[model samples]
Target: MITISVCMIVKNEEKVLERCLKSLKPIADEFIIIDTGSSDKTKQIALKYTDKVYNYEWQNDFSHARNYSFSKASKDYIYTADADEVIDDTNIERFVKLKKAMLPEVEIVQMKYTNQLQYGTTYNYETEYRPKLFKRVREFMWINPIHETVNLEPVIYNSDIEIIHMPVMSHANRDFKQIQKVIQSNIRLSKKLFIMYAKELFIAGEDKDFLEAKQYFQNAIENETRGLDEIKAAQCVLTKCARLMKDHNLLLKNSLKNFADNKPSAEVCFELGEYFFEEQDYVEAAIWYYNAAFETECELNIHYAGDYPLKQLANIYQLLGNKELEEEYNRLFSKWELPKSPDA
Candidate 1:
């Protein structure tokens, strides 16, 4: 049997610490928590789970903190999670068997992170695979001061494990002063890092931040060396920025035009649908929206694929007074393999 240690770095996470640790307790053999100057009961709560908790002064460099956490692990494998992330109860059994069944040759394990980004009563989700689990003794190392990830891409085992991120609804944790400080500290702006900088600022939900977000995203898109996924993501962000600024000209002309030039992505397709939908061009909008929901060779399934397009399609078909067409689309929504939204 293979042993797995769970490594985590936290600060002032008292609210969700117990929730995260509780779910992981049964699975992890070694729990290493590095608390970076928390004033809250986070350290005390961590001690309830393991005496492996240690104090580290707050550092703006995330990779350094993560490397410190990894260095304390004594198990064959290391799995990392955020204080706000929870492993699905359904995935626990599979995870255990996977731990035992994994071959020694496996260098890394990729698992999905489910981020539920809420907008009012409507909930939208975004998912991405990350190498959250890996062999502790391998040649793996983390990089980056913000949004750090392991550097090596050795033979990877794609696991069914999923971590659901449940962030508090309050704005207290929204401040990114520490991250900004690090960014301003002469960090080299790689394409991925650049996108994260923009995303963090854009998520701040201020007028000035949105403008900066637009500028950064446009710059990221123009760089041309980013991966397909990152480029697609930047395009989507630019589209959102255009919409927020109410710059319909940029939405229809600049943002969408730049994205369409590269590839046919579900994200750009969905935006096109919204563009035509607002103009009351139901026929054109429906065409683009259908591609967004059903197109297989999109930039990525999650890139443009979500419950939004399906919901919009049903609305459009119903608007056309075609009950039969609406039912056909409704069936697609009901039968979607991935988790569907409540109203979708």
Candidate 2:
């Protein structure tokens, strides 16, 4: 079996640090924790695991702190996680197997990042498959201050392992702060940064920032021919911004072309249906809403493609006096148990 070094950077995480360390004690070949000026007993807890605990002064850059943590690993493979992250038994087995079978040429290993559950709930878990394990000798480095990421070499392998994140509490304040800091910085905004800023603003519920995000998104649409996913996401953000602004005419005007251009996404169709419903054109609203629900249901059956909008369809049907359809949608809504609010 390949030896694995577990590395982490922490501060004021006394509450969660112990749980995180305990989860991996049995699996890890080595454990290293770098405390970035913890005023709490975080370091004390870390010392129980290994002498690899070191002090790293806060430099206002996550990359700096993480790179320092990486320097201490001496195993064949390096694994890292936040104080709030955990690994389950199944993934532990997968990790062990992957380590045993992995070749030296593998620079990085991407594992599933299981985030939230139910797709839309506020307190629900969020999950995504991400690169978490690394080949130590490959010398993978960390990048970015906020929203830091591991810079991996081109040749990589994916492991069917996972990292589970379980926060002691919600992160709304920190989420907004990160974005606000980025926005306030006197730095040039790349297309990616623009998108990030926009999303943060949207999440922060700032209308002015959302409009700025829309402008950046428009610029992105004008400049790029590729990145269909980002473009589509931006278009959707713009659609929501329009809805929030209650500019029905503008929402209809800007989104109509895209709705017609792409095979109508459930979200897009629902927006159009909403616009028409507000206009008291129930027939058109019903048509668009029905199509939206049908497409979503089909996609859901084929793949776990849609959520919440399925419930919205039920709500719209309730408005349209369709008892049978409403009942059917209600059944699905209960089954999925998606968030009651879109913001959730």
Candidate 3:
């Protein structure tokens, strides 16, 4: 029966703030919100929940705002969430039970943030573990200007409680150009930063930016030292970039290199299927695609790593005039997301 404070920093989150607050209200003992210069009714909506609302001048650094919000928390445990995020009804009971059963030594509680579920949605998503719930200790401070992280002990306890994040609005980085400025000034020098740069480029959707992104990912892979996740993420990006760049040799090289590893990483199976398909090797390509659709697990940078391959297989079978295989995969893919009934 420990008290938990829900701490959050928000700006112009009016659209989804009410929904987020309502869902968290029953679970959290106290609400501590820091407004970062919202022109909208976000603050007005927040005040309905608690009087603990405080104002801070908008800072480009997210960690600053997050740290400041957590500082105001008076509870034993601090849980963080975004306006675009919600703890769904299915997990609410489990969440409360977990909170009640929490022990003293639990420094960080890692919950799955399902950015995208099932697949075939308007937006991309994957299940990622985030330390949203943590003990209210000063040592677990957040870091970084962008993609901020809290340094926590390796003793992370995974919780079954889940959170769904679907952005109701877009706050496209006003700081993208500034990040580029800092990168150019040599203020940031690291493989992580290069990965971030490549990510930004991948999001930009330009032909030239894709090529530049490939180079940045290449740099990350070459310079990184034994950071396996970072290297795998870079390879994930590079494999796709090679495909887009139409460099078949590079694609095969990287995909095979990925497959050569003891365990196949994210999107490698799908990429191999794509590579073989492009080489006009239909049988092998079908085998790879079938493996992707049914067998291997993926945590790829792409959203819907599970469903995307099945959809691709469905299309490939359609092109090959294999209606039996096409319909089977199409059924598998459609089972993920079904359109809502207008009346329901």
Candidate 4:
């Protein structure tokens, strides 16, 4: 059986650090904890488990801390874990079995990261595969008989083990601050970060947060280098920002751009529904809400398409004195569940 080192970077995690360590103790041959300026008893709790606890200054870069933690692992494989994660008894047995029977050629192992939707964070899915384990040292291999070439791609294995995520609070506020800092530093956000920023704003941002992000997304709308999806994401952010700020001209401009594409997102449709609803135009609001719930796909929060617009439609029908439609929409809203996949 191959040995495994569990490596983690933590800060002010005294509440959950011991619980996570106890759950992972059975499978870990060594524990490497890199504390990034923790004022709590997190380091003390970690020292009780292993002597590999080390302190690292907070660099505002999670990758740097993670790399430092991985560097301390002396075992055959490194298992990356977080303070908010836990493995139940059933999965612990599965992990032990995997360690004993894993193929030598497999350089990376993916495990199911579950319980995401419970916190209503940035993620849309409840469960998804994430790379959790990796071989500490890589071996280069030559392939092909005639023309020898080095194998570049790492062999990946998908495991059935599941890690339960149990965070005490949503990290959206902290993430927004970090994103703002990145933007203020004049660094261009990558396509992935741009999408994540937009999704987070829709999921958990308040009016002030959206307003602060207004200029950045407005610039994104005019930037020709961004892809179609990025443009749509930018429009979604700007539409909500405009609505919150009560800027009618800006709202119309962004909403019309989306309509011209013939593929408005559910978020934009819902914003328009809210705009009309506030103006007491019940009929127009109902039209936009219906389009949101039935016609368009959601780019950010799934609730905009699922329960959010459905609830609005029910309310609009009730205001319009249509008992039949009101009851129908209420029933649909109650039965609506978040889709397992984004495409669903």
Candidate 5:
């Protein structure tokens, strides 16, 4: 069986640290815990599992901490995990079997990350594949009989093992601060970071959070090189920010940009619903809410297309004294389930 080193970076994770370490103890050959300024018993709990626990100064960057922890690993493979993650007995058995059967050429192992929507994190899906295991060292090989060429792509294996994520609290507030720091540093956000920032805003950002992100997204809209999807995401953020700040002109400008594509995002539709609803235009609000629930796909926060607008439509109908329609929408709202990822 391939030896595995469990590497983790934590800060003040006293509550869940022991539970996480105990669950992983059976499968892990060694634990490399790098504490980043924990004021709690997190380090004490980590030391009980392994003597490899070390302190690293808190840097705002996660990659630096993660890299430091990985550097401490002295095994064939590295299994990176968080304090909020737990592997059940059944999956533990599966993990052991995977270690024994792992191919030498596989450089990365992906496992299912579940329980994402419990705290309404940035992710859209309840479960998705995330790379958890990595080979300590990669071996390059030449391929093809006639025209030999070095294979540069890492051989990835998707495993059935699922890691349960049970965070004690949502990290959205902390994440927003980190994102704002990056924006304030005058660093350009990559496309992935840009989308993630937008998703986080839609999922859990407050009015102040949106306000902080306004300038960056506005700049993104005027960049001219950003793709349609990025532009749409920027528009969605700006639209929400405008509504919150009560800037009607900004709201209309961004919302119109969304409508110019002929297919509006459910987020914008829901925002318009709320705007009209606030103005006591129940009929207009119902139209937009209907569009949010049925006429458009959501770019972020599936609730906009699911329970959110359905509940709104139900309330609107109740206010309009349409009992039959109100009952129908309420029933739909009650039955709404999170939509599966397209690939799922």
Candidate 6:
């Protein structure tokens, strides 16, 4: 079996650190923790897990701290975890089995990162698989300070091992402060980073900063190489801009454009239908809404894409005072099994 070293860089995460460590300590051959100026009991908790805790000065660069943590891995393979992340017991078993069967040539392994589900009361956490494991000999390095990404050449091996991220607490002002740092540092924000930074600004409710982000997003889209995902991202930002600026016409235009290119995404069609419905253009709105109700395969959408159209059709029929049509639409809506939204 190949030995695996779990390395993590954390600071002031006293509430979450112990739980994360307790979940994986038994499985990991070595536990290396790098503390970046913690003013809490983070280091104390880490000491209980392993003797490999080291202090790293805060440089406002996550990658730098992470790379330092990576350097401390002495095992054949290196795994990374956040102070708030934990692998479930099932995944732990799989990881142990995979470690036993690992081949020397495997350079990297991608594990699923599951985020909290806020879509419904049931809250089914969804997992996104990403590269998190690496061969120590591969000399893998992390890039970027905030939103750091590992550079994986060729292809990274994919695995079903999943990790759960549970944030116990966070610095509420982190986004605005971080963006201010990036902007003030005179660092050139790349297309990718600029979009991410803009999102942070929007969520922080910094309108002025969001405007600055909008300009950056527009510039990024104009100068980008026009990849599939990039176009979708650009469209999303443009739609957000239209919504923020309250230009309903612009929103409709972007939505139509998105539908024309991408396979009528649920969001795009819904927005378009919403605009038309608000304008009381019943015919067009019904058509778009119906398209939205049938386009995507997302489980959360459940029968929403199917049921929404029927429900809206019922509403429209009622509004038109067509009793028979309304009853027919209602019957159709009632016949199918529909999935409820977070509120529903």
Give one digit per residue, the lDDT tens place, for model 4 in 23-56. 9999999999999889999999999999999989
- Cα lDDT tens digits for candidate 3, 1-344: 87899999988899899999999998889999999899999999999999999999865567788989988999988999888888888888989898789877787888877764432122233666668888886455677899999866445688888888877533324434545455556554455555555444433335555564565567657863637766766776777778777787878777777767666654667767777788877777777777765565553434225567778788888888999989998998888653332221
Residue 341 lDDT, candidate 3, scale 0-100: 21
TM-score of 6: 0.69
Identify the runs in model 2 with alpha carbons over 4 angstroms from their true place: 55-61, 89-102, 118-128, 139-155, 160-162, 183-227, 276-283, 296-305, 335-344
Instruction: State the lDDT of candidate 5 residue by residue for 38-124, as single tens digits.
Output: 999999999999999999997788989999999999999999999999999999999999989999989999999999887765898
Q: Write down the TM-score of every candidate.
A: 0.67, 0.72, 0.67, 0.95, 0.96, 0.69
- Given candidate 3, what's the lDDT at residue 111? 85
lDDT of 3 at 190: 58
Q: List the residue pairs that clash in candidate 3.
A: 116-125
lDDT of 2 by residue, 1-344 (tens): 78989999998999998888888876799998988889989989999989989988876566778899889999987888889888878877777777678887677777766664422222222544566778776555787999999875456676667777777765545544554565457444555654454444433335565564565556555655636545555665666667767877657655674566555455556666766777778778767666666664221111112344556667777877999988987887677643332221
Model 4, residue 109: C-alpha shift (Å): 1.5
Give stretches of model 4 more than 4 Å off. Answer: 142-150, 342-344
Residue 216 alpha-carbon offset, candidate 3, angstroms: 1.8
Query: Lowest lDDT 10-mer window, candidate 6?
Result: 116-125
Q: What are the per-residue Cα lDDT tens digits for candidate 6 across 169-253?
A: 4442565566557766976565565545533432333445445456555655576465555555555556656656778786776
Please give the lDDT score for candidate 5: 0.92
Q: Report lDDT (CA) for all predictions.
A: 0.73, 0.66, 0.72, 0.92, 0.92, 0.69
Q: Which ten residues in a row have the lowest lDDT in candidate 3?
A: 116-125
Better of 3 and 4 by TM-score: 4
RMSD in angstroms between candidate 4 and the native structure over all alpha carbons? 1.9
